[model samples]
Target: MELGIFLLAAQFEAGDQGAVLTAALDAGCAAEVAGFGEAWIAEHHFVPYGVCPSAVTFAAMLLGRTDRLRVGTAISVLPNTHPVLLGEQTALLDQLSHGRFTLGIGRGGPWVDLEVFGGGLERYEEEGWAESVDLLMRWLTRRRVAADGPQYHFREVPVVPRPLTRPHPPVIVACTTPASAALAARQGLPMLLGMHADDTEKAEMIRTYDAAARACGRDPRGVPHAAAAVALVADSRTEAVRELRTALPKWLGLGLPAHQTLDGHPRTMRDPRTYTDYLCSIHPIGTPKECIARLRRTAEATGITRQLLFVEGAGTRERTLENIHRLGKEVLPHLQAD
Candidate 1:
C-alpha cells in the first residue's frame, strides 16, 4: 500500500496554477511525513496540461523538501531521451536524495505521446522493445559503451557520476499487456498496472512475469514487483468523481505530435477535449473510502506489492490533496501487511 503521486493537473478550477503546483508538491511532502513509502513524477509534453514533463527535475525538487520518501518517475519516455543523459540525470538525483531515487519506464502505447519521437508502437514489437531496453540498461550501467542499433548508435563513452545507489537505483516498468508484463519479468523489473482492470488479468500478468523471470535464470523472489494506476480519492464517491470531471477536457484533448511525446498514448492537450472522456474508461476514480476498498481488493486479488497512485491535473487541487493525505492516513493502513 505504498503511495506515489502521478504529475497531472486535472483540477485547474480548484485554484490558480501556482497554488496547484504547490498543492501537488505539498502533498508529496505530506505523504512522506505521513509515513508513505515513495513518491513519483511523470513526463508529458506539448501542452499546459502537464507542466512537469521533466520528472528527473521534479524528483530533484522534491528530494530536499522531504525525508525518507523514495522519489522517482512514473515513467520516463526512454526512446526519445538519450539513455546516458537519462542515467546521469536520475543518478544525480539519486545521489542528492541519498539513494532515494528509482526509475520508471513506459513505452506508452498511445499515439500522441508516441509520434513526438521517430520511434512508435511498432518499434516496441517482438525484439524491438527488448533490444531498446537492453541498450538502455547497457548505457546506464557500463562505463564505456560501443553499441549501434536501428534506432540508436553510440561509441565508446562512459556516463559520469553513475548512481549513488549500488548497481543503479531500482527500475520499474509499466506493464499491462500480457507480453509486456512478461517482458518486464524477463528484464527482472517491477511493473505498474491499471487499478480498475480485472484482478484476474493482473494476476495473469504476474504469473507471466514470474515465468519470464524463471526463464531468464533469475529467481522470482529476487525481483521486486509493483503496479501503478490512475486514481482521485476523496471523502465520498460523488466528490471524487466531481473533482475528476474538472480535468476531463484536457485528458480528452490529448493526441498530437509534440516534442516530448514518447508513447503512442493519446496526448492530453494535442487533441480535442473529448479525449479525456476516453481516458476515464481506464483510470480508477472514487471517494477515499470506496477507492481504498477497491484498492485492497486489487491487492488481494493481484498480489501486487505496491500500488502507484497517479493523482494529477484530473481533479481539484484541494480535493486531490485531501484524498492523498486521507489515503495515506486511513486508506493505506487498511491495505497493510497482516
Candidate 2:
C-alpha cells in the first residue's frame, strides 16, 4: 500500500494564509522526501476545511517545490464549472507539473456546493455523472470534438496546445456510495473514497467499487481504489486516544462548512451533538501500531492500494507536521511492508 498526505487546509486562527499554504507545502515536501507517493489536495468554495479551493492551482504552485511526488485533487466538484474549462485548467497543471497530475471529479456536496450552484444531488446519478465524465474525457482527449448534450455541450473545434502528458492526465472519481462506486467501475475510472468512513465501512466500500468495475467487464486491478481518511499517529496509544478525543468535535466543525454551501444553506443534516461516537466511528485515529492494524485490516478486507491521510484540521501546524512526519516514519513503512 502507498500512503499519501491530504491536508485538511482548515483555517488557522493565529496565522496568515501564505503561512498556512507554505506550511502545508513544506510538510508535503518533507513527505516526498519521506517516500510517499502522492500529495492529494481537496477543493471547496467558501469552506474553512482548507482554503486551497483550487487544488490544481495549489498543485501548480507545489510543482517546482518537490520532485518524484505526484499531486492530485482528492476531488474537484465538476458540475459547478464547464468541462472544457476544467479540462483546460488541469491540463495546464499537468504540463506545468511535468505530467504529475490526476484529475479527481465528483458532484459537489448536496448540502453545500450543489444547492449553492443550483445543481441537484440527483445529478450524481450514475447516468448523468457518467455522461459528464464522458464529455470531460472527450474534451480532454479528442482534438476535434463536437457535442450537444443536456448536462454539457461542445463544438467541433480544434483543441490546441494539447496536454503535455500523453492520453491527457489520468482521471479519478470520488465514490461516496455503492451506486457511485459502481458508476466509477463501469466507467473504468479510479475511485477515491472520502475521510468520513471508518475501517469496516471503507473496506466494504472499496470492495463494492472494485466489484462494480469487474462487473462492468473491466479489470478490477486496472481501476485503483483510494480512500481519504483522518489520522493521528503517536508513540503511545493513550496519547493518541486523548488527542483523538479532544479533536473529534473540532473535526465536525471543520466538516460542517463543507456541508453548508457558501450561502450557508443547511442541506446536509449531520448532528454535531453526538460528535464522539459518530466521528470516532468514521475517522481512523490511534497509535502507530493501532493505525497500522486498521490500515492492514482495511487492505485485507477491501484491497485498497492507496489512501490519502487527512493530517491537518483544527490542530496546530506544528502538531500536524509532527503527526505527519511520525506517520511517514512509523505507520507507513509497516503497512507497506505488509
Candidate 3:
C-alpha cells in the first residue's frame, strides 16, 4: 500500500491564511522526511475551506522542495480552467519533477467559482465534463492534438516539452458519484475516491468503476485506484476522537458554509458536527494499532492500494505535523508490510 498526505491547507479562523498555507507547505516537506511516498494538494477559490486557489502552482513549489515525494493536485477543477493550459502545465511539471507528478482532475461543484472563472454553469454539467476529459487525455497522450468538441474547438498543436512519464503523468479522476466513476472508466483512467465515503460506499464505487471499465473493453484490475480518509494517530482512540471532534467541526463549519452557488439552484451543505462524527466512525482516527486496522480493512474491502490521508484534520500545524510523523513512523510501516 502507498500512503500519502492530502494537504487541504484549510483555514480554521479568519485572517490566518498565511499561517495555514505555511503549515501546509511544512507538512508536505515533512512528509518526505517522514518517509511518505507522495503528497496531494487541494485547490479552492474564494473560501477558507482551502486557501490554495491553484493546486498545480502549489504542487510545482512542493515538487521543487522535495526529491522523492510525488506531488499531485488532489484535483485541479476541470470545468474552471482550459484543458490545454492545464495540459501544458501538467506536462511541464511532469518533465521538471522527473515523473513525480500526477494530474488528478474533477468536475468541481456548482459554486461561484464557475462564474468567477468564466466557465459558466454549463461547464459544470455532464457534457462539458466529458468533453474536457477527452481533450485533456488527448493533450497528455499524443504528440499533437486537435479538439472539435462542443466545449472546446481548437486547431492541431504540438505537445511541447512532452511528458517525462510515458503516456503522460498518470491522470486520475476524482470520483464522488457513480456517474463520475463511469465517466472515468470510459476513459480507462483510475479513480480518486473521496474521504467523505466509508469503506462500503467506496467499494460500491469501485464495483461501479470496474463494471464500467470492463463494459468499455478496458481491464480494471491493474489500475491503481486511490482512496482518501482522515487519519489521526494518538495515544488512545478516545484522545484522537476528542481532538478531531473539537477541531474538525469548527473548520468544517466555517469552510463548508462559504460555498455559494453560481446559479440560484439551492445548495445544502452537510452538517459539520454530524459529518465529523461520521468520518471518525469510518476512518482511522485512533491509536497506531487501531489506525492500521482501519486502513487495512479499507484496502481489503475496496482493493485500493493507494491511500491519501487527510492528516490536517486536527486543524493546527503542530498537531497536524505530529499526526503525520506518527502515521509515518508507526502506521505506515505496518500497512506497507502487507
Candidate 4:
C-alpha cells in the first residue's frame, strides 16, 4: 500500500493567506520526510476552497523542495487550459523532477469553474471534454501532431522537450460517475476516486472500471487507481471528531453561491450539531485506532491499495502536522501489515 498526501492548500484562515501557503508547503516537505510516497496538490481559483491556482507551478516547487516524494496535480482542469501548453509545462516538470511527476486531469465543476475559467455556462454545456482530452494525450505522447478538436484546431507542429519518462509520465483521471470511469478505462488510464463514496460505491466503481478495461482488452487489476477522503487522526475519537465538526462546515461553506451552506450561521463560527453528524456519516474521522479499522474495512471491501489522505481541509497547522506524522508513523504501518 502506498501512502499519498492530498494537499488541499486550503485557506482555512482568511486573515493570512501567506501563512496558509507556507504551512501547506511545510506539510509537503514534512510528508516527504515522514515516508510518504507522493504529494498531490489541487488547483482552484477565485475561492478559498484551494489557494493554489496553478498546481503545475506548486508541483514544481514541491519537487524542488523534496528529494524522494513524487509530486502530482490532484487535478489540473483540462477544459480551461490549452493542451499544448499543458503538455509543454508537464514535460518540463517531469524532466526537472527526473520523472517523478504524474499528471491528473479532470473536467472540474459545481458549474462555477466552467462558468468562470471555461468562458461561460453555455460554452461548458456545449464543450467536447473527451475530444479535448484526446488532443491532450496526443500532444503528450507524440513529437509532431496537430489538434483536431471542436475546441482546438492547429496545423502539424512539433512539441519540444519530450518527457524524461518514456512515452510520457503516468496520466490519471479523476472519476466521479460511471461514464467517467468507463472513459478512463477505455483510454487505458487509471483513475482517482473521492472519499465521499461509501465502500459499496467504491467497489461498484472498481467493478465498472474493470469491466470497461476488459472490454477494451486492458487489465484493470494491473492498473493503479487511488481514492481520497478526509482524514484526521488524533489521540481520541472525541478530539478528532470535534476538530472535524469545526473544520468541515467552513470548508463546505464555499458552496454558499449554490445556496447550499455547511455552516448556516452567517455570524457564528462553530458548526451545528446536525452538520457534525452529517460529516461523521460521510468522512473517515477518528483516533488512529478507529481510522485503522475504517480504512481496513474500506480496503477489504474495495480492494484499493493506494489512498490519498486529506489532512489539511479542517485543521490548524500544528494539528494537521501531528495527524500527518501519526498517519505515516502509526496508521500506515498497520495498513501495510494487514
Ten-residue region with minimum lDDT total, candidate 3? 260-269
Cα lDDT tens digits, model 1, 9-77, are 333453375665677787788778656788877666655555566777777878889878888786777
TM-score sort, best first: 3, 4, 2, 1
Q: In candidate 4, how many clashes are counted?
A: 0
lDDT of all predictions, in order shown? 0.67, 0.73, 0.92, 0.78
Model 2 misplacement above 4 A: 12-15, 111-128, 254-265, 273-284
Pairing residues by index, what is the TM-score of model 1?
0.80
Write the residue-wise lDDT of candidate 2 on 188-265 in tens digits.
778888766766787787678767777778887745678787777776656765665666556566656455544555
Task: State every prediction's TM-score relative to the real structure.
Answer: 0.80, 0.87, 0.98, 0.90
In candidate 4, where is summed lDDT lowest over 10 consecutive residues? 256-265
Clashing pairs in 4: none
Give the distance in Å from residue 267's predicted Cα in candidate 4 to where it truly belongs. Answer: 22
Better of 2 and 4 by lDDT: 4
The sequence of per-residue lDDT tens digits that candidate 3 reaches over residues 13-70 is 7786888898999999999999999999999999888899999999999999999999
Stronger candidate by TM-score (1 vs 4): 4
Error of 1 at 336 (Å): 3.4
Clashes of each: 24, 1, 0, 0
